[model samples]
Target: MKLKNNVLVTADWLKSHLNEPFVKVVDATYFMPGTPRDALSEWKGKRIPSAEFFDYDTRICDKPSSLPHMLPSADTFSKEVGLLGIRNEDTVIVYDTAGIFSSPRVWWMFKVMGHENVFVLDGGLPAWEHANGEIDTSEPTRVEPTNYQATFDQTRVIDKSQLLEGINNGTVNVIDVRPNERFLGLVPEPREGVRSGHMPNAVNLPFAQLLEAGKFKSAETLKMLIESALSDSKRNVASCGSGVTACILAIAAEYASGDVVTVYDGSWTEWGSDHELPIVSGK
Candidate 1:
């Protein structure tokens, strides 16, 4: 499938192409700390016709780590995605209950795993519903498993060592995507005993600022928002409460500047928990 732009697609465009062959739709809805909705159960209950559930939390990550939803190994990623009936040549569209939150994480995962044909459904499920598009509560048609090759791009992801180096060397701009209170260390972290406050030398650009209602803002507006966060340095890395929403900021940064963005897979969940890492509070 030919995509107009690689990063995102509109609801109308996706609706028109729903029946196209080799097009796989993934329901990637995820909730935050206090939300009552269970993402997997909700996807099982109702989703777009022929859409499969991509459990963002389970599909990726170092399970041993206490941090939530970290990136998985390339081999693990390939196996899991292959089991979902995804092929290298397929045009994958990911959508979530929230317009532009969890879907981009899946989109980024595909990119990090070396699949370039994936995209996030702009405005997500709500946008589709608003357009009066058809939805199916029934289980989707399953295709035979296909071979998926993952060529992991290590540069697109940041680890603890790299994060520390970036901060000390001032080589990359670390942008925290948590809420102001969380970033400022004024509020207790949702995860138990994790230290509050932002990473040293990191700037705060809460993920919420990048969205309007249930959708992403205009490209120009997004660019401007990110521009204000940067000083003289050009390199950018994004982090959030966990690893999930950070991908949303990374997607926005990519759209805004067309620059390569890195995600701190462990993010605050790992950073805040470690007593050895330095932390600072307030603006």
Candidate 2:
């Protein structure tokens, strides 16, 4: 089923518009720390035509931060995205090799940077291959850099302090998108030095529940799943391992309920490592 929200575009739609001047395709794939597959290497081997790799981990992130892929400054984002030949008016389509994995994070990043025309390519590269979309293995042609402006939207993200205040004050519903095993401290975190268990009062949603066969479920299904976890009056905060998968929840929330989710950018990486913060395990 097609995504009800305008935030996503199907592979078929992208295949037809691949050569459009106003449409800019981006490969935003990312692999976890222990994964053997390298996203950049895989992209180099095979990717959609005219696609530029957006390196969220290294090139487009806050370099000084200890956290992984923390959001870069507005100026940095504008500069880096402009270097990719993306203009403010272009219809940006982002996708990952792992279907829906890191694409939403890139899409959310664009939104956070005040780019409204950005959309995630539903089902990603796999779907494109399925649709017989043209694949380009040759080196990406360098395009002239365009002027791009970015206005950072602080309301889209929440820091540790703001999250704590919201959780303590009961003003926000903290939705943890990690697997239940990780959420309940049943398994050790992949990252060292970080503790298991979830934030106090955070509910486990498990990002997979929002997807079916690596693609987002229908809007009705998403709405049912999201509404089950959130309260009507409280704001929503999406959190996950190192703040990446949290964007899936953020997109799901917006797609389902039209409620914008304020992502906890530091997420478990920051909260779990700090001994002072409270963590709860087991239902």
lDDT of 2 by residue, 127-162 (tens): 888889999998767888999999999989999988
Clashing pairs in 2: none
Model 2 scores what on Cα lDDT? 0.90
Error of 1 at 230 (Å): 3.4
Off by over 4 Å in 1: 231-234
Q: Name the top lDDT candidate.
A: 2
Choose the strongest candidate by TM-score.
Answer: 2
lDDT of 1 at 30: 84
Candidate 1 residue-wise lDDT, 157-221, digit = tens: 88998889888887988989999989999999999889999988888999999999888899999
lDDT accuracy of residue 103 in candidate 2: 93
Error in Å for residue 90 of model 1: 1.3
Q: What's the CA RMSD for each of the models?
A: 1.5, 2.2
